[model samples]
Target: MTRLLGGIGAQVLAVLAAVGRVAIFAAVTLRHLVTPPFYGREFLGALLNIGWLSLPVVGLTAVFTGGALALQIYAGGSRFDAEAVVPQIVAIGMVRELGPVLVGLMIAARVTSSIAAEIATMKVTEQIDALVTLSTHPMKYLTVPRVLAGLVTVPLLVGVGDIIGIFGGYQVAVRSLGFNPATYLQNTVDFLEPLDVLSSLVKGAAFGVIATLMGCYSGMNSGRGAQGVGAATKSSVEAASVLILAANFLLTGVFFSA
Candidate 1:
């Protein structure tokens, strides 16, 4: 029993130490953002990779989730004879919670793994050292651009996801659920407050930062070989996904608790 307790305490301390390291990494990265010698081409490439390339997956995920949510809400509402409320419910649900969370998780799965693997491989190849040799700050050249691009573009992705999701619900409702297209849209528009959209975009920014930061941190600190690269890639996605969900919960409570 004593040994088990000791192990648990050691694990907790290790986790806390890891978190502290990540925080310091993030701070250093942010500080580099305002410094000169900005990498415009790299930033644009990262924007394209992290934001534009991610759209198809985000759209498909949002549309299917929204359609399924509409069906589920409709079925449940029918039991209460409140089926007509589907539009309002769907709108609020998509804008307030599902949109941001789904987009964030998708990014974690796709972008986080990609970033970690690529960077870890670069490190293993000694490219990071080469950058240092060339007098280029690796953090500024590599990490800053990606993190900045994510911070800027993910909110836009969330907005797009929210629209696509609402449209998906609208399609299902109007085509299969026998909802009047015009009235359904009107109800959806009327029910959603500006705050819902604002909170969603805010969550997107937060999740984006977490996703990219985890990837960069894991990659920079990765071990020295193929197995290390694989482990870093795996751990980056897992950590980003878990942190996204936890942040979502905390943000929701902050935004909604009154």
Candidate 2:
């Protein structure tokens, strides 16, 4: 039992060490955030890559999720003869919780994994080393733009997703559920305050930072060759997903808790 306990302790220590390394990387990256000689080209490119290109997917995800959520709420609420609350509930839930969380998770799977794999491949090909030899800082050149883009892009994406999601729920409620169009919409608008939307944007921003940081960190730390790249890609996705979900809880507390 002592031996087993010792092994578990060692594993826990290793995990903590890895997390510490990520924290150090984050601190170093943040230090460059306020410095001059900004990489405008990279930042703009990242904005296009991470934000503009991501809209269709994010919008689609939000629409379907909101529609499904409304349906579920209607079904459950009907059991209590409270189906009238579907539109309002769906609106609040989508903007406050589902919108940001779903968009964050989707971006984690798509953007985070892709970023990690691309960077890992570059690392494997010695591209990162070449940048170093050329006096180009990998952290600034590679990580900074992606992180900045995430900070700017994700919140926008989440906001867009929230709008689309509410629309989706509204559509389903009016058409399939036979809800009065004006009544449904009025209820949705009545319940949604400025704070609900703003909280979602904040959640999006945090999720974006968390996702991009995980991707950059895993890529930089990836070991040699194909196996390492695969490992890094997998790790980035896993970390981003867990972080996004955990962040949702925290953000919800901050936004909704009395």
Candidate 3:
């Protein structure tokens, strides 16, 4: 019984310690963000990697999700002869929740894993140490650019995903479900409030920060060798994905739970 309790206590402390380390990492990243010999070249590379390269996946996911959502809402609404609500529901659903959340998860799976693996490998190869010996701050060079890129570009991705998702629903509704094309488009536009869109973009920004930060943090703190890199990559994606969902829940409450 004593051993069990002690184990539980140790787990709790470990979790808290992890949280504290991430907090400090984030704080230092923010500080570097403000004051820097800004690395424009690295930042641009990260921007391309995190944003432009991510579009196809984001668009595909959003479109398919939107279409499925429309179908589900139509099927559900049929029970009450409320099929006309499909457009409104789809718009709200995509913009308010699904769009940002899905995009964030995709980014975590793709970008976060890539970042972690790359950095971890670099660490394993003593490249990070090389950076230090060359009078470079690894955090400023390695972490700041990626985090900034995520911050800047993820909201844009969310906005794009929201639009693509709404378009997908529009296509499904008008083509498959006998909704008037004009009316479907109008309803989607009319039903979405500015706040819904704002919330989505905001969630994207938060998710971006979490995803990139976790990847960098895990990579920097990774142990040694190939096993460590693999572990870091896996953990970075897992942490980013979980944190993004949690942040979505909290942000939704803050924005909508009036």
Q: Which one wins on lDDT?
A: 3
Cα lDDT of model 1 by residue, 1-258, tens digit: 999999999999999998899889999998999998999999999999999999999999999999998999999999989999989999999999999999999999999999999999999999999999999999999899999998998999999999999999999999999999999999999999988999999999999999998999889989999999999999999999999999999999999887
Instruction: Show pairs that collide, candidate 1.
Output: none
Compared with the true structure, what per-residue lDDT tens digits does model 2 show for residues 1-258?
999999999999998998899889999999887776589998998888789988889999999988998899999999989999998899899889899999999889888998899899999999999999998889899899999999999999999999999999988988899999999989998998999989999999999999999999999989999999999999999999998999899988987899
Instruction: Write down the RMSD of all candidates, one decimal each.
Output: 0.7, 1.0, 0.7
User: Can you tell me which runs of candidate 2 are displaced by over 4 Å?
Assistant: none
Which residue pairs show collisions in model 3? none
Task: Give the Å error, residue 83, model 2.
Answer: 0.7
Candidate 1 runs further than 4 Å off: none
Positional deviation of residue 132's Cα in model 1 after best superposition, in angstroms: 0.3
Local accuracy of candidate 3 as per-residue lDDT tens digits, 84-184: 99999999999999999999999999999999999999999999999999999999999999999999999999999999999999999988999999888
- The candidate with the higher lDDT, 2 or 3, is 3
CA lDDT of each candidate? 0.95, 0.92, 0.96
Candidate 3 weakest lDDT stretch, 10 residues? 183-192
